[model samples]
Target chain A: MAKIELRGVVKRFGENTVCDGIDLDVSEGEMVCLIGSSGAGKSTLLRCINLLEPIEDGAIFLDGQDISVPGLDPQAVRARIGMVFQSFNLFPHKSALENALLAPRRVRGQSRADILPEVEALFARFGLADRMHNYPDQLSGGQQQRVAIVRALAMRPEVMLFDEITSALDPQLVGEVLDVLLTLKSEGITMVMATHEMGFAREAADKVCFLKDGRIIEEGPAAKLFDHPQHAETQAFLARALK
Target chain B: MPHQQTAGPTRRQIFEARQRRKSLVIASASTITVVVALIVLVPLAPGWSKVQQSFFNGAVLAKSFPKLLDAFMINVMIFAWSAPAIAVLGLLIALARDAKSPALFPLRIFGAAFTDIFRGVPVILTVYLIGFGIPGLGLPRPWNSPYIWGSLALVLTYSAYVAEIFRSGIDSVHKSQRAAALSLGLSERQVMQDVVLPQAVRNVVPAQMNMLIALQKDVSLLSFIGPVEIFRQAGVFKSLMANFTPYVGAAIIFLIVTIPATRYADYLMARQMRERS
Candidate 1:
């Protein structure tokens, strides 16, 4: 497991600053849920931790190692930290099993024979055994997202970052993907997720952080935050988002 | 299933069948009228017989056929050699154009310059320059051979067009796909090899097929530098016989090769569209 720490992480696109001097910590095996309105910078923070976006100011530490230094190889850091996107960007050219198998075979240098059984077990355990051979186009949105999760997990990542992984899924399909996350949490994988599912965050997240205007407005245990939000902004946001 | 098949032609189906037959009848009548009119009207023209004698003489065509076919082998030979070179060079140039690293950015400029020069120049001009220009040096027999220089010219110019087609194919893959690949712990090179290139090549097949047929036809343009290919041989036959029939025979040979290729390209494009939709 990995502990992720962000110290004054700032991200900008042109003149707009999306993540302004944000500080956050995710302990090992902890599930931290970032809740926010659109443009509140929750997703940007997650991307910063994954090193997908370059940080303008501040450092991200993966297991106490500062990974944000310029010229350092991003691949080494990325290999240990897996991310899933809201769009479920499964490669359209490959089958679900191949998508899960590609990274381990290439990056980790695991032979197909060495990795196949475990990867197959992942699919079977996630209830996707029959869909493994089907192409991404042939699968439903939820099945593809599960395969995306499986693809990430196949690498045996110490930390998993989920950037609104269920946002594009149908409402009926969202529960299946969320169930996979709960299972992962139970298995002791550290995770940070940007989500709009307040109920899931309240039920499953170890901590709930409410973000607004690129800053964390309030953060506490899920029950505490849901029951008695400290900030007026957090309360107002919750009133609108929880509806 | 058997019951559904047996109950197949409903009243609406019968009406649709009658409509189809009516349209077919109308289309056939109009097509036949257009064909008969062209056949009758062309023959009635005063100069038609002389035109036919010069352009379509059976004796001249028969005599030219054997020599033309033999000469045509040179064009086929040039195309065969140049195509693999173009495919390899084209992909390299396309990859060069897509270079993202700071150190490799110069290759992007080089790729752009390459495509600009080769695509901007007319095919014949490029063929002439490389074919005649290089041979004009006091090079030895093999180096001065038009066959070598001529094929080189085709490779350079067609590589430009093929590279652009490949670049467009690369652009069509969504950015999210790249992000997903990168996030999966694959390095940039691995992502391109595993994720990007396979899809790009498949996406560009129909367009690339059209380019191949074009390359096949343009191989004859090398004759200007004097390899005595089909087009040049046809000229030889025309002068020897004092009739244009040999040129007509050459056109028939070219059509025989290219028409099937064009139809195949169309079939590939249609199938791709169906699959995508």
Candidate 2:
């Protein structure tokens, strides 16, 4: 069974449907990238899997159990699947270290003493050791996004979601954040991300799903998907996206 | 000027400095004129001396000063006790207003009703209603004491204003922040206590400081229900001495407290704005 599975998931905002009968799978340690134009429901799809947006019709399953049932606690499911946002969303009032330490201590019921050394090590591993003492406002865009990633990792979640994490960074700063993702992939975390970085998606994604208007137009292994056009919509999106 | 060896004071700088001096002289002259006119013209009024004697009697002021200070301490005590209650209750009300759960709809309703009723009705009327109405129930001992009931009134009314201020502060926090916290698996309560309130409260400190200044003055409204704070004490002195100077003294005392607080609040506001920008 896939590690995270969505079966005909549907999401709507008022009159507009953002996720139209979506189906996807992320097996253990697989990196699946969702690539699409802006407002193509890529972010909303990721948000739904994280239970940030309640789906109108569909079941989300984790480890063969339906996780999207309305009464199931989102917090319990969320603790197992971490998500990073387009905006770093680091608490401005807290130091990077505190931001990383907060969720594990509060949600996972770990004492700060037990969580600190490991979280500090995660910061160091991400090349954020010196910057961890600074608040989010004090950090550069790349550094803040890295801290946000570390904050998600601190929960030690089984599955991780990235919602256009590098899209907010400057062009020059984008590489560092993408590099962090490569490291996470190599370390074998089950990861799914909605991304605008076509180069990174082509190079690093195990699976690439091309989405348009809330539906996946085409999906396959990253190499095949990028090297050959399987669908007209995918071909058109890639032409403009690559150009 | 362009060929000068040293850039010692450009011509424009010299002109600007001279203009600055000219404006300063004019400002000083105008201020002095206003001051001299007030000094000269005030006593020239037909009833000026009698008006001054009634409102500004130095003897009455001196006699009432110590006692007024004593009564003002009551105001301070009421303020000190009520301020904490207002803050805690106001925060709870704010959180209630922010309730997102369908089951918590009543709490949201209660929060909305509370702020509307207390903020809409005149504060003095609320004071009279609570201060007199509650005690009129004839509760035994301290419960019926106006000190207790009167401060309760202030807490209720000020808490409504404070709750609205707090709600604004909470609203100022971006929705994304809450999403970020919740995405971390934090329970709603944890998200609020840990993530949202800290930023919200910090954002509104200057506004709350203004509330504090208002509260300090409004504590004297308790005097109507018979707490004998500064306002009531002044009334006693006015009746006894048949002079209004005590009222003038009371105003001075209030200015002494509030003006410094007002300045400090402005300082905090400026520093916060600078930091945010």
CA lDDT, candidate 1, residue A239: 92
What are the per-residue Cα lDDT tens digits for candidate 1 across A121-194?
A: 99999999999999999999999999999999999999999999989988999999999999999999999999
lDDT of 2 by residue, B1-277 (tens): 4775556888889999999999999999999999999999999999999999999999999999999999999989999999999999999999899899999999999999999999998889989999999989979997889998888888989899999999999889898999999999999999889999999999999999999999999888888888889999999999999999999999999999999999999999999999879
RMSD of 2: 2.5
Candidate 1 wrong stretches, greater than 4 Å? B1-19
What DockQ number belongs to candidate 1? 0.74
Cα-based TM-score, every candidate: 0.94, 0.94
- What are the per-model DockQ values? 0.74, 0.80
The regions of model 2 sitting more than 4 angstroms off are B1-26, B101-106
